[model samples]
Target: MAAVLSVYLDLALGLVVTFLLLSLLVSGINEAVVRLLSIRSKFLWAYLRDTMDGAGPHGSWLPTRVVDVFRTMPFLRDPRPAHEARPAPASAGEVPETGTGASMINLLYERVREIDHGKQGRTSIAEIPPARFAVAVMELAAANGDVEGLLARLKQMGSPLYGHLKGVWESAQGDLDRFRKGVESWFDGEMERLSMLYKRYAKWVLAVLGVAVTLLFSMDGLEYAKTLLRDDAFRASVTAVAGSGQGAYDELKARCTGAGDPVTCVTETLSEPALVKLMGQALVSVSLPADGEPEVRWNGGAWWDRVSTPSHWPGFVLTSVALLFGAPFWWDVLRRIAGLRSRR
Candidate 1:
């Protein structure tokens, strides 16, 4: 019974470690693709337009005078081109800024821009907090004295923005604070839906990256498990490496603290160099089939025979599916399995 349990532990630990390494590689590649394409920014921009101007086909959403306010906001009014680097912030109490920077919308755009591109500034802001966005919209709606007057104007103009503000006003029961909170809640709900769509898109990216990484690395999930179970020396080496890396994993986890977005946290935490180093450590335990000669000779056997008898499709699929679970899931499993083994 003890011997069987030992074999099981070895197999589990080795497989978990392997999956964790593969997850890091796939995740990093996916993040790179996302960054290159500016996927998050695109999604956020689309959401902003749709929410402000009602759902419609892709194009500029500035039809109404109020909606055009987005283009005239403090940040948007800069004469400098979009590609130019933003000027450094004013030093101490000295204010040499040419633009009147008293807009909350400017602060929100700057904050979101910083989050998306680090210190770099871009014309397009990726993320807008629901609370800030709601406040900005309310301010725009009430630009001329009161919301009722704006709603009267909005009705004449047949603007979609009127319906959104009217609903919030009715729900607020005449309380100004309640109206603001209601607007925040409404925007927050929309953002939640956007988050779901973003996650769905991310899953597709993960699936593609997972398969590519599996094929490139020759990671066959079934074959790896079989090898670990059958080869005691290799299994021990993998288990040892996996166990010794606990401190590194813990440190990485610590660094992920206060990362508001989970996906961003993962991508930034397992950076390119870190992923390469970890994968290198994991690969040192066992050689992949790609590192070896073909088991079936192309000249000796028929092409169909070679393809059918020694095909890696099943193994590739298995590994790819395993990687979709991501690194954090496998890391937790590794920790639990290690604890179980230690207790025995």
Candidate 2:
């Protein structure tokens, strides 16, 4: 029985490994496909531009829509005369910069006004037009000859416009910083999520395989049952009924094993009423022993006896570890999958 169980267990382990590997492969393929399909050259360019602008003394967070638009337009990234970087005209301050920075400052003021009636359109450091502000900085830069001194003066001037431009520039810098942080966070989160997902998948496959192993291992119990059926005492009882040489056989034939219950080895032997009565009398004379005393059969001998075996300890430890650690991970994955499907 133990040998048979071991064979089944080994097969189950193999199946579990196969399933786990398959799940990992599937997940990897899915990740790769998503990466491949999401090749956003335009988005990359926009990101780079935003990065550059932020790095410049005057850029802010680009709008999500701008990112989306760039993603949709493949040629947007390609260099063109219009797209080429041109130095801001020293006098372009009169014309408003029309993009993320301007839009964000406007949006911020609008939101602030909505929340505070008394503070309606309060001049924030974010609203100074970049070009106008850049000209101011250039003038400061030319006057001071030292970029650091110019920056320091701008920081010291403390006018609402100066403050707003500085705030906007700082805010842009902050946003770019945040984007870098977000990228790192996202990569870490994604890698962690994938690892957890794989571990969970592995566990679930192992569980199903474990159940199958248990079922296969229980097959030995069926064989034991068969052995019980073929016991000498059971056969003798059946033989004695057959020996009752009379019409008993015909009558009791219909009463042999009612409903084919293997536990009760009796079978219908006759159909005739008189013969059935005779067969019944003969069965009564054949007395079988009561059920044998219950026994606990250990596969690897007593627990202590098998503890010293190298295979026994490792197998036991691994199985225990798998069950203890793997269950929660598996449950989490199932929950996540359920959540994802629900969203869909």
Candidate 3:
């Protein structure tokens, strides 16, 4: 019984170890796949943002439209001189002091319209011909391709257009830099946040799967124990102990008593098909008899007495230990097989 139990115990232990290994393998494979796919922080953030912000092809444009409005029309402008200039004449409810490059462009277009109207009327300003002045200014601005130098030249010419142009240019440069830095920082932060979230999600999924596998194996182990306890040979062995009070030895002695030499009698009893079958069955069962079953006993001075030793208690303990450790490993092996098949 001990030998049989030792074998079963070995099997169970192997199975538990196999299960642990399989779990590790599954987790490693999942992580490797994720890494290989490059499904990291940046990708997660972009996916989430596009999904939530409705910027993708199938998405609504409402959020983006609102954001565009806010970006184009900030509530406050910088108090610096660059942002406090304008070319457009002050109108009702208009701040006369503050204008931007966009305002200057608007002013230029308005002036051109006025010149064209005057020319049609045959009363064009000859000293500062509008077309010539516009062309010359455009050429000068393009010559150096330096926006600040062009604004300075315009300022020397002392037009509201100069101040407006300079203010708009300077403000745009600072605002552009600030906006760029803010976008970069936000992108970086979002990536980090998404990376951590994914890691936690993966960890939780792995943990849950591991626990589920363990529970399944535990149930299997319990079923195995039940099967072992219910074997026919096990039932018969237990009954023999209760009836004869000496288990297999008592039965053997009773059968051997009148069969000539004591050694021959013992051998003949052991060789009986039924007894051999019982021993074989006992070896496999390995479970203890149910509670209240009689203890095994043998003749006071016989070798059989030494062999009985109360009951098959040791076998039961060893078997239990083997199964306790082996079930998880066996479950793991089964899981690995399943995983391999799935991959295929």
How does each model score on lDDT?
0.57, 0.35, 0.39
- Candidates arranged by lDDT, highest first: 1, 3, 2
lDDT string for model 2 (157-250, tens) is 3322334344444544635334334434443453454445334434444444443332222212222223333332334444566687554444
| lDDT tens per residue, model 3, 187-303 | 455456655655555554455444443332222333334344333343344457657757455544554567779666544433343312233232122223346764443323432
Query: What TM-score does prediction 1 earn?
Result: 0.60
lDDT of 1 by residue, 219-305 (tens): 667767765654554334434546885534544445456878845665543333222322332222222343565342223233223
lDDT winner: 1
Off by over 4 Å in 3: 1-22, 35-42, 45-53, 57-181, 200-344
Q: Candidate 2: minimum summed lDDT over ten consecutive residues — where?
A: 76-85
**TM-score of candidate 3 on Cα atoms, chains taken together:** 0.24
Q: Give candidate 1 misplaced runs (Cα > 4 Å).
A: 55-124, 153-159, 233-310, 340-344
Which residue pairs clash in candidate 3?
A: 12-326, 13-326, 15-329, 15-330, 16-328, 16-329, 16-330, 17-329, 19-332, 82-167
Q: In candidate 2, which residue ranges exceed 4 Å CA deviation? A: 4-8, 24-28, 31-35, 38-50, 54-344
TM-scores of the candidates are: 0.60, 0.20, 0.24
Q: Name the lDDT value of residue 247 in candidate 1.
A: 38
Clashing residue pairs in candidate 1 are none
